[model samples]
Target: MKKSIIIAAIINCMAISSFAQEFGKHFADSTLRLDYIFGGKVSSDGKPECQVLLDGLVRTTGWSGRRNNLVSMPLAGNGRVTVRDKESGDTIYVTTFSTLFQEWLAMPESREVARSFENSFLVPMPRRLVTIDVELYDSNRKKVVEMSHNVNPSDILIVDRSNVNPNPHRYIHRSTHPERAIDVAILSEGYSVAEMDSFYKAAEIAVDAILSHEPFRSRADEFNFVAVGAPSSDSGVSVPRLGAWKSTAAGSNFSTFYSDRYLTTRNVKRVHDCLINVPYEHIIILANTTEYGGGGIYNFYTLTTAGHASFRPVVVHEFGHSFGGLA
Candidate 1:
């Protein structure tokens, strides 16, 4: 037993070392943002046809994602992003996700009209040229559509957003270095500049609520929480059913897809743009509303009401979907 245990330990250490070397050889310490448009419609044969298109590529400062899991995935999500070495055709990096577009396609609206949704993903900036493949899957876990393209690290056309000013933010819970921890950014959606302090307090409560649960409770030190104070001209989110609209930070709204309780934002690119100044792999937007509604999409984001009576539990539950990858 001791010999076997020793061998396992040695192998694990070697694998870690190998991944670290691979990361250094292939990637820089920056982030490469892949912007995509996911769209779908019914085909001539009455079959659902889905497609993915590369909207843009952005370069930003710092990479806070996992460097060890360079090619392995913990979850086989609804969609995938694969980055490969153009020269050797070897997969250097990969990530998976679930999208709002995938959910919208299941609804009746997709059949009635073709529509598209914005999605953006961040990968460690590559040091050399690479080919990227974006894919979407259906309910049966079959690939519906895929788009491929090459990216040159030295491309002059890639948008350089590294110098953009980030929203005001503060750390609610400080953990290990960003490279070794899960960084969660809690963004203020509808809070005005005067209400930022209240948002900070709510973010603190959110941190405590999340860490109070198991897995997170036992591994609390592996997480870091930052409260982003993105103020609004008017407080509270939009309620289209009541004709109540306000100028919120991320343009979040209730009644998504005509479902009153489904709260979400279509401005995914804007969300990523806001986090350029912070270290975030997962996002949790705290809208300053008393409405009892929230939404979460895997590898996307978590948005919930901060002033509702069930704030604590709702934030925890939504974080499970965003961070824990819970169904």
Candidate 2:
């Protein structure tokens, strides 16, 4: 029995060593950001067709995502991003996500006009050339459209934002290491520079709310929460229905798709730009408003009004959509 146990331990160690070596062989201790335009329109036959285009590649410091599961996804989300070695044609990494564009395609507006939405995703930086394929899937798991591109690590055009993000930030909770924990960044959306203290307090409340839940409560130490203070010039978010527009940090607004209280931000790239200096795997934007509304997209972001009477539960519910991938 002892001999068998010793042999099993040896095998596990060997597997760990192999995984590390394989990861180090292809990736660096950095991040590669892929920016894309996802668009679609109704065809003459009334069938909706969509396509994705490469916008740009960005390089940032640190890879705060998973070290294991480099070649697989736990959930087959609405879309997939696959990274493969250029020379070997071997898939080295894979991830799945859902986007606002996918949700917009179901709207009547898409049939009347062609529209595009900006999206951004992060992968571990590759040391060599790699081919990346971004694919969208239908409800039946059939491929809808795909865009493929090659990325070179030495490309001069890749924007380098390796410098520390200059925005003011505070850690509500922390983990010993980034890769071992789920990092969540709460960004101040409509709050002005003077209201950052309030934002921090709200972020702390959000952390407490999240930790009060079951699985998260048990695994609380495996989470890190940071509040990024990206102040707005205006003190509140826009309400198009009221003709009240504010120049907020994220360009977020209520009445998304003409639905009052449905708040969202189409400036996805800017949402990511705020976190270039912060380590985050998930995002939560706190709009400084007393309005009672919020929005969430799977693997994208959770945006909720911070001053609402139901702020605590609303934030928790939206997080279930963004982080928990709940319906």
TM-score of each model, in listed order: 0.92, 0.92
* Clashing pairs in model 2, backbone N/Cα/C closer than 3 A: none
Rate residue 267 of model 2 by lDDT: 96
Residue 152 CA displacement from its true place in model 2, Å = 0.2
Candidate 2: tens digits of C-alpha lDDT, residues 116-211 = 999998899999999999999876788889989999999999999998665889899996644567778999998888899999999999999988
Stretches > 4 Å off in candidate 2:
1-19, 176-179
What TM-score does candidate 1 reach?
0.92
Give residue 241's error in model 2 in angstroms. Answer: 0.8
Quality of model 2 by C-alpha lDDT: 0.84
Q: Count clashes in each candidate, considering only residues at least 3 apart in sequence or on different chains.
A: 0, 0
Regions more than 4 Å wrong, model 1: 1-19, 43-46
